[model samples]
Target chain A: MLSIKNLHASVEGTPILKGINLEVKAGEVHAIMGPNGSGKSTLASVLAGREEYEVTEGEVSFKSKDLLDLSPEDRAREGVFLAFQYPVEIPGVSSTNFLRTAVNQVREYRGLEPLDAVKFLSLMKEKMKLVEIDQKLLSRSLNEGFSGGEKKRNEIFQMAMLEPTLSILDETDSGLDIDALRIVSNGVNQLKSDNNATIVVTHYQRLLDYIVPDFVHVLYNGKIVKSGTKELAMELEEKGYDWIKEEADKATV
Target chain B: MTTITKDNITDSLLATVHPNGNSEAAQVIRENGFPTTKHEEYKFTNITKRIESKIQSFQQAKPLGLTQQDVSKAMIKDLDADVVVFNNGQFSAELSSLGEGYAVTNVTNSEAPFSIKDLYDDSYLALNKASFEKGVFIQVPKNKVLDKPVLLLNLVKANDGQLITPKLWIDCAENTEAVFIEQTVSQDEQAYLLNGSVEIKTASNSHIHYYRVQNQNNEALEVNNLLTDIHRDSTFTSFVLSLEGDMIRNNVTLNLLDSGCEGNMYGLYLLGGKTHVDNHTNVDHTKPHSESNELYKGVLADTSRGVFNGKIFVREDAQKTNAFQQNNNILLSDEATINTKPQLEIWADDVKCSHGCTTGQLDEEALFYLQARGIDKKQGKALLLYAFAGDVLEHLKIEAFKEYCIDLVQKKLGTNF
Candidate 1:
């Protein structure tokens, strides 16, 4: 479970998230639909504890604990996972090596035993098959020359391996083809459980078709103006953001 | 002593060389000065800075404990081949192993009827020739194949108030092959200086791999001159790794004397806490159809200073000679300074030669990627920096030397394991 109360964040003194307040309970997929420059990414990054953002006023609690006090690495260990929009490419470090180290670090932080190589490889095999990822890609350096879809699939694969309590996918389906989108979305759906939550952030409603959400919220000018059932995403897709803009104007007037 | 001022030490030292032997190499240094900052060949390294300031008489190393048991121990290690181990610059013959293909003899006089050729007037060689108490001669016969890599352990005892000057020579006959590892290590953390010279000659179609690990004690100074000559179709590779010392200088030269020869020079130096290490490498493409490559990397921290100078020269007759050189360094502290220069001079119009050098800190993007994976900042930096210098470590060729490099890097990382 996660709660954001009037999240006011900015980057380089320029306000991006004016006021955002959302609450997501367990076993629910919430879609935050936004046009460009709507603070969707700023929310994901601020939650992930990116140092560039300045939180002027707001409070975000994850699992009933303050998230602002943790560093990015600490936040990562605390079951707050952000599937990066653009995954970083680290050369000379193999994918398996990178993931193994990350998994063990998180496990160690939570006072759990680390997985051995035999168990880790089996887990990776099962997850890669679920995400339709090639095993050869995992043997090479981490995303050094990976294709667009392969990178997205790799992100989902990592999500399955880490098994975080709350996962935020910030535009994971942007560059993916229909097949990759289906596989990635299917992997996310499979990993869903009654004790965890998910937030799907995107600009289009195409990905929502595969991974249905409990609630759809339209974000414009840094604030969520409209919240409804899944039908709200279909309405925004057909009528465009102009209708949301009009409703937002009436609310302000 | 009047001729030994720091300002004109080059001319003073070379001017006093008593070169009465048949070697024209020794005669040349007696006329011209020692390598100075004014010399274009030695411009980047500034070897004169250290040599000129220390004006003691060039005498043989005189340590307190040069017992016969140390010589016998040295002999046990090199039982199969011709090897000369030096402890504090004294040859431990009692511990040496001599082979049938080679004859270990002391240079009683400079004018011996030997097949060895001293072609260049390198002042360092002449200085070694003039001052060293003993020298080692290792020879491999024609068409011979050495199955084992020779280990020449040059040990500097701790707290031994001794200065060392080591002179070594190796000759490979035509179509022969060998690998030589010359390791320089100290037992104690004492202040001593070593002036050393090594000369290698490879016959046509032979190949040699030479590795030198300069992990002297922190309170020691090491100055080395390594010269190698490759004949037609011969190949030569050298790896230099420097770990600890106050002042260390590694001077390497490769002469591609014949057509279709190949040469490679690689080194990695990790220094901290006021350590100063300098690597100067030169590749001379003298004949056509030769090839050469060189790369040196360094990581310095805590007021340490690193200097890397790589030079490649292709002669007019050396058409089709392909040469490449690169030097990269990372300065971890703001006060840590790195001086790097990659110079190339090509006289042949049809040569493929290129050179590059750079100095900076760890790659920020790479650092961030590692940190994002939950790796702590200290370990992340260490891993990326180690990977940056991996190329040099991999090229060590010898298994022990490679493992030593890994251990050294891991130790440098300290308790952050």
Candidate 2:
């Protein structure tokens, strides 16, 4: 469903992701994990077409389309979603209004009819229950004065509404409590299907406990050093990334 | 035929003064002449130059055949209010409807409540006093709460080099509540100058809300002076919506005369093209335990220019006064400019006063966030600008008028509200 071949990315002349090669088929989840400054979030930002990160050398293909060539909005319209770690607080726009515009634009891009207000409201109500979010929260300004948990849940609510083909969750569990993490994971699990994919980027293996991944790749110094199964995550939780760092350094030398 | 030059502009205007005009006001205008850019008050606004270049003569134009249909077309749709129409600053009795609980009369026929002596320093005020031939005096009796708002629809249809002076005096008696909406519309595209003034007096325990909407043609030059004297325990609130004009200057002053008075001034200007709009607001707290708040926002596109000068004064006897002022602007184009200044002078020790001004472009991160949600760049920008304007739009009390203003803003920004 998605492919990244030698994707080299940088920000302000400093290389962050160097020669990253990844491929994922349908119905599978990939987890990119490493210590701090391992270029985990940078990879997610590059995939989402953030203008700050310049893709210096590589091509990213999603569903046989050149993803890097598209603008940020075009990327979202083409079924690529990025759940921001720090969602912006826009004080005047209501959450419902924002979602309506997003949904209609995405639908138009997919050659589908736009949903009317009644239809959109019904869809919102159904998704609201999946994320355990209240209607009052959606009526207020988008993410304005929202709590940490509410913001994360709203992101999931948006994800459920858009139903993107490839979902990238960047540090979603960083600010979540135990209860919020459980609820968020439940929403992501329910939204998963045989034709969709998700990439979970995090530093801790605790998030993988709720939404397990099929492949776990350890990233260090802008390169994926090791690829393993779920057991590697448990092992890394027991021992820190020190052993991995030493091994990677020796291999480089 | 007299050719009016910049040096003889004042003489040409005074030659056509009304028979009831004040001699002292004429003397003041003769002495001060027209303010130049060197003057402190008119430093940024070059209204004299605009007037000199556009208006060749100060003679009144021949009256265009305006009727009730023209007034109705310019009115806000579905607005439930008492309507009064004016054509080129003259009251059109055939086009107006006098509702219950209020009396409207010509200012010259009635006992005028406004004096030019209080505002002797301004040549524009003197010009208005010396040349205004037609003015309205509206009185609301004591203890009467008006059921509907009063809409003063002033329509302008003038030839080149013509001048229109619209004057109004509104007196709300003690313990009364009322709302007034003053809207200006140009019937033609002729270049003209509108020198207008409004004097409002809210007695003890009265509450008044005044809304002024300026949506004139591109060739219209306007200078509006609005002064309100708020008495003890009264509340005076004003909203200025400047949407379109070639050169527009609004001078709004509020005097909190007694204790327990409250005053609020809110303004929003969305301008494009070569339009220029200047808002100069002053709030004076004269007695103890009074409060005043002022907020003005502007969005300049194209090569448009905007100026906001907000001044708040707390006198020595006005102890425990609370005054706050803020001015914000957004420049959409490279050539668009905004000069904002917030001046606060407080002589009282026990007072809470703060003033600030900010001018910048729209937030790039906020725009990107909206774009990331699948909205295009243009729609994202429009949404952000509308939200930026929400700070002042939220203060609108009338729902229909609010929606009307929102529609205008949406149309101006080319997006949905």
Per-candidate DockQ vs. reference: 0.45, 0.68
lDDT of 1 by residue, A1-253 (tens): 7999999998999999988999999999999998898889889888987778899988999888899877676777888788888887777778898889888888898899999999999999888888989989999988889998888888888888888888999999998899989999999999999988999999889999999999999888889998998999999889999889888989989
Off by over 4 Å in 1: A243-253, B1-60, B64-84, B96-126, B158-162, B410-417
What digit string (tens of lDDT, one per residue) describes model 1 on residues B340-360? Answer: 877788899998988888888
Q: Write the per-residue lDDT of candidate 2 for residues B1-417, one digit (tens) a residue.
A: 358776787677777666677777778778888888987888899998898888876775545588778887988977888887777887777788878978988765124566522432688877787777667889999999998888998888776438888888899999999889999888778888889888899899999999999877988899999888999999999999988889999998899999999999999999999999999888989999999988899899989999998888899999999999889898998999998888788899999998888888988888877777788888888888888886797888888888888888877776321
lDDT of 2 by residue, A95-198 (tens): 99999998998899889999999999999999999989999999999999999999999999999999998999998999799999999999999999998999
Docking quality of model 2: it rates as: medium
Instruction: Tell how far residue A156 is off in model 1, in angstroms.
Output: 1.5
Candidate 1 pairs with clashing backbones: B71-B94, B71-B95, B72-B94, B72-B95, B74-B95, B75-B95, B75-B96
lDDT of each: 0.77, 0.88
